[model samples]
Target: PPGISMAEEARYGFGQPATEADIKAWNIDITPTGEGLPPGRGTVRQGAAVYSNKCAACHGPTGTEGPKDRLVGGHGSLATEHPVKTIGSYWPYATTLYDYIFRAMPFTAPQSLTADEVYSLVAWLLHQNGIIPATMVVDAQTLPNVTMPNRDGFVADPRPDVESRE
Candidate 1:
């Protein structure tokens, strides 16, 4: 303590350690198994309205004509010369989709949507992708069961020799 300069000590003391509540609030990650999913539910019909109001401007009215990343269609195009990687054709888990929409969607305002809104968006997107029926409701219990088209298409990375930076 005596050897360290005041400037160095001041630099280290700049920020306070995060509290448990702070960590909990920031820990909104959702796994592929729907673990850590929040409590809420949404229907395809409800999602359509949320998408129109919050998502259409950047992602297009249909999620395909997107000025941003396309969210639908592109099924079975992975092997083509021009593979159109969309949510329906590419994402492996519906729960992960919910995670993405919940964390970094609407482009302008990230992490602003309610859990119900996120669920609704996922339901509508899955319905648009033909992965789910229009009448299906999406929630923690049901969302994990909705399989993506490319679920079996992805292979585990064979490079165990490579170390993860994380």
Candidate 2:
């Protein structure tokens, strides 16, 4: 081990540069089909409590705001010259909603919510957006089944073309 540094040895000691275990630990993604979703459930009513306690101040009650970004409403604005891109009118993926909420929501306390809380928040937002019924409970099984109105509105990015060259 003469002339071999500890740092060099440590770098070269691994069999694979990165193992599946490492990748899996870091990649905590939930799919649109509810795959990888955690076990929990939240009703719209429960989400209302959660939202008021954790979310409303920043997102505004009922998701409408005088200053902050709106999380709901603005449905059927896709054809307008200036559309208000809210969850109801723009987002195409329900899993993205869950993922975003789980990872970065409640602005003041990011990532502070439980999986159930996240599900509840998603349910409440979707309901406010008019995408889901208010009485429904959002869980691993039900979250994915709530079809978004703009689900098919987005066309695949036909990129590498002239318009996208900028």
Candidate 3:
């Protein structure tokens, strides 16, 4: 925290100044909306094959049998004493799914999947969880529209409660 004033950093920076383009390039964050959904598409059938080849090794063939994380099922278990929070059970949004896969996945390799591959993986996972039909395709338009089962399960964060009502 010491010797890191904003003025000093702006005047004579110890590192190279980043351009607007550079900032955007590094800002790969995708919103809950369809913000970063690239122009790509993938069907459930196609996703099945992709998952078998690329993801099943880690997440299991059905996503529910994974040693890493069980992505499917676990609905209505939140009320139980020992709940199983999973993608089908606890994820709030589908865009978050797309974003996560795009940024970090495969365990062995991150940022390795193309836009299409990411879409396919999301589709497969959603379909395995029964969120979408096997015939359904995931794309920029469809991915954001997917509503997770536990969408309303999370309560709003009650932080900064004393903020001024300006």
- The local distance difference test score of each candidate is 0.90, 0.83, 0.85
- Top candidate on lDDT is 1
Per-residue lDDT tens digits for candidate 2, residues 101-122, read 8778777677788988888888
Error of 2 at 5 (Å): 26
Error of 1 at 84 (Å): 0.9
* TM-score per candidate: 0.83, 0.80, 0.81
Q: Please, what are the lDDT tens digits per residue for candidate 1 over residues 11-101?
A: 8566778999998899988998889898999999999999999999888999999898888999889999989898899998888888888
**Candidate RMSDs in order:** 6.9, 5.4, 7.2
In model 1, what lDDT does residue 127 have?
Answer: 96
From the highest lDDT down, the ranking of the candidates is 1, 3, 2
Better structure of 1 and 3 per TM-score? 1
Q: Which stretches of candidate 1 lie over 4 Å from their true place?
A: 1-19, 158-166
Task: Note the clash tally of each candidate.
Answer: 0, 0, 0
Candidate 3, residue 93: CA error in Å? 0.3
Model 3, 1-166: lDDT tens digits are 5878898867755677889998876676678888867788988888888789988998888898878888898988989998988888899898898889878888788888888888888998888887999888899998888888888878889988886976
What range of 10 consecutive residues in model 1 has the weakest lDDT sum? Answer: 7-16
Local lDDT at 96 for model 2? 84
